[model samples]
Target chain A: MTDKIPVTVLTGYLGAGKTTLLNRILSEPHGKKYAVIVNEFGEIGIDNELIVGADEEVFEMNNGCICCTVRGDLIRIIDGLMRRKGKFDAIIVETTGLADPAPVAQTFFVDEAVGRRTRLDAVVAVADAKWLKDRLKDAPEAKNQIAFADVILVNKTDLVTPEELREIEMRVRAINPYARLHRTQRCSVPLGDVLARNAFDLERILDLEPAFLGSDGGAHHPDHGRDGAHAHHHDGMAHYHDEEIQSVSLRTEEPLDPDKFFPWVQDLVAKDGPSILRCKGILAFQGDPQRFVFQGIHMILDGDHQRPWREDEKRESRIVFIGRNLPEENIRRGFAACQV
Target chain B: MTDADTASLTERTRAIVPGGLVAAVHFLKDTAAFVLGEAALLLAAPNREQRRVAIHDGGILAAACDGQRLVTGGDDGKVMATDAGADSTIVAVDPKRRWIDQVAIGSGAVAWSAGRQVFVKTAKSEERTTDVPSSAGGLAFAPKGFRLAIAHYNGATLWFPNAAAAPERLEWKGSHLAVTFSPDGKFLVTAMQEPMLHGWRLADAKHMRMAGYAAKVRSLDWTADGDWLATGGSNQLILWPFAGKDGPLGKMPRMLAPAQGLAVEVACHPRQPVVAVGFADGLVLLVRLDDGAEIVARRPGAAPVSALAWNATGSLLAFGTEDGEAGIVDLG
Candidate 1:
């Protein structure tokens, strides 16, 4: 698994500095060669020889599941890139402005050949700080990109006032509170913040728990105070006020029953998969010493037994779901019923 | 039975190091043309003569052969053909430098795909092109006519290059790859993005779903009589019976040569009921369909075998691996 190539997906709204970020990644003296797959080939002046073009052909599976869609072009391009395995160190895929990042992220989990040779490192989304508040009203794709991202860049901060920047951050935090947010001008942030983030790997699931809990447990919640109220007001805006997209995190000190947890989560995902974009969990099953780590993109779920519990670590179960119009009460109730 | 009962042909094999991973291997009479993953083709003759020919500017993406010439599509946006004498020709190059994703060879014509468009060129005719709903995943020429079958996202499309009629679409609601027409031209089969094979009976467009594969089917071939379609995706060699008019609709597939590793490539003998099965653990076997007898043509020690082919006379079998190990075995 260590030898598998890491793939970073770059997404944003139009003119959100995606090309500028890509050009910066290629022009930097990192000394690591990357094979970049972009929607338009000749627009960016990238110096890499492995730059390829993609048509973003999203394909649905025949199983009658609506949420089980994948990027067919990524499968083909990755297969082609694997032929020259030693020629490049990693891969970066630049999606168009109007594209959804779910299908791109699901391609790694759905295809056998692509999953065997490469792993999804992260989904980095760039947002125009000046225009994000306005675009969030009319563009649902922009919100989907923010909701599906692991790292987000509020680029073009130079064009906006500090109050407007604060408002943009509040809006982004309302939609997705768990992502690592950065303020940048022309996407001039460090490259380390956007690349090689094994955000989807099972082994790295709990390593980012500090930020996850920090967002959900403290400042971003509705009950928490000023920043929280601002976030709530931001969620009350035109597009997502009644049934908005948000992240819900559940935690319990008691161990969970394997029999009850498995059936409930599977049934939940099967029933509500189209509304759910991403879900992940780390469980402490009754009578099991191992930590069970799992992640899901829509209806497809993958889980495995990680290492055993350490004596110093607390035995807690935690799970997070990011999606549109999620049933928080039912999810909380269903999760509470799985506990012993 | 046991390993002791299986006959051994390991001693009769001659090895050839192609210097790169082999994408495919095609037999031109008595010679084996190994298409490397890079930009070269290594030709090895029966009398120990070997030569390397540079064909593409970048990695080769897809390859197909017509027993006399080999046609290849590369990431360099070029489609090229090489004959048995090591002579190469540039068939076509994409104007926008889009990668040629698939290639298929017919009687006197050639077909290749770039993105959602498929281009075909026949002798004494201009180049004709058509667009599919999505990227062309696979392409195949019909055995009996001037027709071509292209597999894409929703299903496969059947086209007649010479006819002015609309191209026919066989819908199955999934991504289809690696399409082929039965030797008798009675049925069309496509290996889907899922780990299964979907077929359509041309007489009536009836759907035949062949499921239960462990991985996505990558290699499929027809038997000598075209009665069986052997596929690779599981631990055993799976052959679906295509002899009856119903075409494996109600019957189960015959499984042979079960190994510990997954079968990744398969090639059937031209004149016999024999199949060369290559496994992910680098094991190659020849299985006879009559009684399920097995012969160990190559042992499991190197990388997975990615390409396999049999000569027209079935006297020689060629195999190549992902790590560039290749060899030819003389059955005679």
Candidate 2:
């Protein structure tokens, strides 16, 4: 099988210099023809005008992002681009500011056709240093965006002082320590710093955002204990008023029924609604050692099985939830109940 | 009711349309069914009413309701017509070099525009097609028999469907977003990608321009009486009265703010002259064309509304969102 094309999702709060970063990447001397999927082709009209490439070579999805609703369009576009093969170097999807990145990432996992062609590189989030500090407090999109980033670009350093930038960087690291942090003005950074890195270390994610990694012995899991402590400290931050954005991870050695898993997730989303921003996991079923990846955003849920586990790898199901004031015990119990 | 309760009720109403995927739901006269692009169209109506229609060769780009028939344009570059109620027979299939962008139907003819080409099928037997190098942007049917207006990337063209005469070109250079003819067909309004909205007299082609929107005008709708035109852009809606000196009557008033949501689609009431605005954040608000007072505000979650159309009676409003979900709300 041919190697899957790595899809790097670029997400940030509105006007956080995502387009500026994209323009910088396009203008780089590297002969990489990127297939960019943006919400609106016209909104980035000035950036499009500046990019030096034939219109056909630079593909734009136009209408919307690649989420639950437009995943078909994303798949179709990826399939079409793959047929032309040697035309582009990589696919960079720039999601709308308010979009939850989980659904977009789930596309690469769920569709066999998509999986054969595209693998997720990383979710790069560009955060506004000046406003993000306060936005992380109440804005669910901001918190979720930051929580999902594998590389967090704390952009707009010129807007803040050294001390303020350090504070923002600390906050981002606190929320997501696994993400490589960078501070820049107008998202100006070395392309190598953000690109070509496979930042999705599932094991590291289990350590960093442990709010989603739950355990019965709350004191046993170091990551869980650290997250709980951070949750308390984050409450003191004043900006995060309600803990609207929290991460919790659930792991189980028992096998789970895939059929029951779907409805349980649907119920969880139905009850939580908008507060449930992102949920992703790799499940190890009883009979099948192969991993089952599950992901959902808001009301959209999609999951599928991956390659069988290696002979030496441990078999365990790990699921994480990044959302607002999520009830960890209740979620843990829900997962425990799903075990077959 | 408390505000939270009201908000929850609105959300529940919005949730009637399933989230996460863009699956096409076709409401036939007798059955309501859902169709996934990958799977064959399924009809889940009571009494086992299901039939698969071979309409698309690749995937459907756009499908519109033409009277009682469904007209579809696909990536296959073929425009096919099928009965809306049942898969009885293929009405007509036209092959072309590129995908059909837009289609409009009138008295006895169906007109469609595909990249650089416009074709009109009249009387099911007579077909007239024209090859224009300029790509068409929007297609609209005029009130007169066999009359159609095709908005190209550069300008607009007036054509007779039967090919009785050569098409007349109304030359104005800009990317036109929409071209709408008045109810009486006396005036043609074209909203371009630029800030200017042009109004032209069909008889002499005398035009007037209105400017207020800071961004490209995405949607435009004429009042039922043909006395007012509602143009929306950058989250603001402007009502222009076609009364005074052929130009905009005066300063354009801002009906809604950006905070309310960016207006993406608008539909005028079939009779009462009230306008419905669908916002990018899924807030649907109704405004009176005369005074611009909001009649109703409905927030349908965060899915950007794609299209809005008022039913024939004007009492029911159907709006489609970017998520491929459509909602029918009762006004009365």
Which residue ranges in model 2 land beyond 4 Å of their true spot?
Answer: A1-340, B1-54, B82-97, B243-259, B295-297
DockQ, per-model, please? 0.77, 0.02
lDDT tens string, model 2, B93-125? 654235455666666567776655787777675
For TM-score, the strongest prediction is 1
- Report the lDDT tens digits of candidate 1 across residue range A151-170: 88989988998667766777
Q: Can you give the lDDT of residue B274 in candidate 2?
A: 84
DockQ for candidate 1 = 0.77
Model 1 interface Cα RMSD in Å: 0.9
Best by lDDT: 1
Report the lDDT tens digits of candidate 1 across residue range B129-162. Answer: 9999999989999999899999998899999988
**Which residue runs does candidate 1 get wrong by more than 4 Å?**
A214-243, B1-8
Interface root mean square deviation per prediction: 0.9, 10.9
